[model samples]
Target: MDSQPPSTPPSQKHGQTGNHSRSHLTPEEQRRIEVNRLKAKAIREQREAEEAKRIPHPSPTRGTNIGTGVKRSFASMSSPQGPATLRDGRTGAIHTNRPLDSIRPARNFAKYVEYDFSKMTDTKGGFLTEDDDPYNKALYVRDGKKEQKPAHMTQKEWDRHQLLKSTRRDDIMVSGSKQNTCCECGSLEIDRKWEEAFGCCVCSSCKEKYPEKYSLLTKTEAKEDYLLTDPELKDEELLPRLEKPNPHKATWNNMMLFLRYQVEEYAFSAKKWGSPEALDAEFVKRESEKKRRREAKFRSKLQDLKKRTRVEAYRRNRNGPAGGNFGDDLGSGSRHVHQWGRAQENPEIGMDIKKCVDCGMEVEELEF
Candidate 1:
């Protein structure tokens, strides 16, 4: 069977046989029509070019279709409109945001007028009066020009507003700890950081004068040198640590800083270790304990080594074949016999134990 001829696509067919009336036109008519189309295109392009020149555009364009070179968002394209309220489609009630605004502006007053049966009607509840109004008088709503409270607030609300204002950080004194003179020397200026955090109103020179007290210690140093625990270090009230960003890692927990003297004081306090002498005693004890543990571990390792190693049986080769040591045999042509040691009573087994001098082998003999 023969295959049918390849079918042309609808788009291709439409394109090839476009406008049957136009296709039947003479060459002169077609030329005139094409000239008109070209003229129209030219005029459109000229108008667009003029518009582009008249309105300045940003550099590096978005598209030629838009006058503004920058891409315009959908929100920017729409006109700026104030908020408007319309009736809810589900309830057919006026929107809560603007109850009066939802109604269309008209000459009819009845459309805008709304009523609440609970307040306005004289049957169900009662006729509403000025006493039924929720809002109070708007007189004391403001204290001062800037301290003005929001409108329609109660006396209690206005009092709360003033109370909150009084407690503001700007109004309250943050720090009144003024000490101009240094505690150690008679210097006028003291170290800002030391006085603020460490409660030391001393100059940098005085801080250097007493290195043992004022010297800063790292968290690790404090723990190792002072023998303080994690819980003790974490106690802010007790230790009063100064936190700083970790120098090694930005993401890690902040590094805690403490004065050497403070750490020493806490470590040697009555609640802690009592005194430096007591701290020294504890330190020594820990060191001795650590040494003991090391020795025990070493001894254990040695025992393990002994257990893992295979012990060879003691064999004394005889001169029976004339290939053994001459002194190894007690007599010619014979294997050497084991020389036993003095007998010791083994009370647990009720046996007399004897060991050979050469091979270190033991023998157990029961006696009546």
Candidate 2:
């Protein structure tokens, strides 16, 4: 070691390596750096605190995920007073912690079960505790067998038959009879109009008395006045109507007559116009559009009229002014009239220059 220090490698020829021989700071400089670092750290912490204050604290009820503040719908179940289970209105599904495939109907619904067509009822024991005899059924029931397709039927025809036969009629109301008593005044005497036409139990006195509610509404009146849509008025199930031959034309389609109250109810409901105010707004908008179209039409007609008048005036002037050879230019034999414009001074020539208003012909004349 004392004899000779090992020669440094060429790669290690420059400054000290491996963090050795570092620059040493003075106490003041080190203090300043430490102070600045502490100040920066404090500022950063303060900013973080402010940011935390600005946003709501992460809550378990907010969502399973952190940061986002969206209130979870399922969060209520975690509470003490939540419902035992959540039920879906449309799907009739009971919400649970399990997977979708694992979920099932609470009770065995006959509609979902396989068909047993030898019997009138769907289920083995029937839905009722006491199975009523088929002949004495309160309502008409039909549940055709799966294997009941007619002989020599093609695959297409068989498939179509199966499709039509698959309709579930377990809970359907096919036909029923109602009481003969009047729905309005309870009078034994009811109108033939209500009973025969609309199949409603309403007396003739009530029909005339409550004109606003019981009165008939034509298809045109329902659409234009009440702002009802085609689907709403056309659907017999939705709004029952009476049909009659068109009074205006026999060849035309039959007129549909809807009850005034039914039309009004549908019109003001959430489905159509929503409210009276909304209907009024729609009417105003339509009227304004109609007025704008009318004005535009009038403007177009006026422009055409103006163009026609201008063309006629041009033709009259070109063919020579009516009843006039009076203003013909000298030595030309052409019938051209000079409707002269106001005279302007020609200062250099000490004369007045006049130009034709229509033809742009100019003439000079000495004037005092």
Candidate 3:
């Protein structure tokens, strides 16, 4: 069998260039193809432009400029017109045109005033004493000086002002008279003498006593040089010597031995010394003065009583027993004891408080 020639459309046979592959064409398809090609080109150009904008510029500090011998100055990485771009303050748009010098000063809008620390007292890392109140306090300053009459505040608020002074240590003021209730018993029978019993202040109560415990701590150690150089004893001395610790007492009294040694080693004597007799004389004087004051107080109270008695006698002499017209309405001058006995005996006597027969409960008058 012989091969046959492929079938060719009439458009190809006649060399029609517009529809070179096909025998026929539509106008809409040609237009759509051209539009698609144009869109692809536009998208590629836009992506390239965005990539150029994303690329960062080199800063001065990382490398030196070839032209200049001096070190390169670098702007803040967070600032605008640098490798890290920032939004404009006013417009909120990405900034890149201006240098850092132009944008930095404007970026820091706040004005900070310097404070004066010359008057500030040194704390020395301890509880501040009462004398440090004036020195430790500070005032607000703008440009190394005090701020002019800033603002007026209420008395309560002014008392709590920031410049108000305070001590670092805790102050405990125990007012005995103001303390009415005992902390232990919750009874209103507290007295001034309760705090004297304990070394530390505490509330008064007879029902129970507060249970407390104490521990002795060694805050310092004794040195060998002082003990050996003592005049009372030598290093190679006998019993009760400064160099040797008490064998019997030292077994359970390590802290006491250390304290005794420390005090004896470093103890300094005062220039002026007062004897025991002097202290006794002063105490006797105080006692005598206290006794005189008590006698004076008693005499004053007696005088007050005498004056009251005289006034009562004068009133009784001026008017009769019950005192004029009002006396008749008030009845006889018999004592209230007699009426109280009759009222208790009377079965129909009504009272605010009554004895109950059943539960033996007394009915008490209750306030609204």
Higher-lDDT candidate among 2 and 3? 2
Which 10-residue span in candidate 1 carries the lowest summed lDDT?
Answer: 312-321
Candidate with better TM-score, 1 vs 3? 1
TM-score of 3: 0.22
Clashing pairs in 3: none
Residue 355 accuracy (lDDT) in model 3: 40
Decoy 1 TM-score against native: 0.38
Candidate 2's displacement at residue 128, Å, is 58
- Tell me how far candidate 2 lies from the true structure as C-alpha RMSD in angstroms: 29.2
What candidate 1 gets wrong by more than 4 Å, as runs, is 1-180, 311-368
How many Å off is the CA of 79 in candidate 2? 99
- The estimated TM-scores of all candidates read 0.38, 0.37, 0.22
- Distance from true location, Cα of 171 in model 3, Å: 35
lDDT of 1 by residue, 255-357 (tens): 8899788788888889889998998898899999999999999999998877655331113332232233323333435564777878998889878998765
Error of 1 at 216 (Å): 0.5
User: Candidate 1, after superposition: displacement of residue 359 in Å?
Assistant: 27
Name model 3 segments beyond 4 Å from true: 1-10, 14-273, 320-323, 327-368
Candidate 2 minimal-lDDT segment of 10 residues: 167-176
Residue-pair clashes, model 1: 0
User: What is the descending lDDT order?
Assistant: 2, 1, 3
Error of 3 at 186 (Å): 50
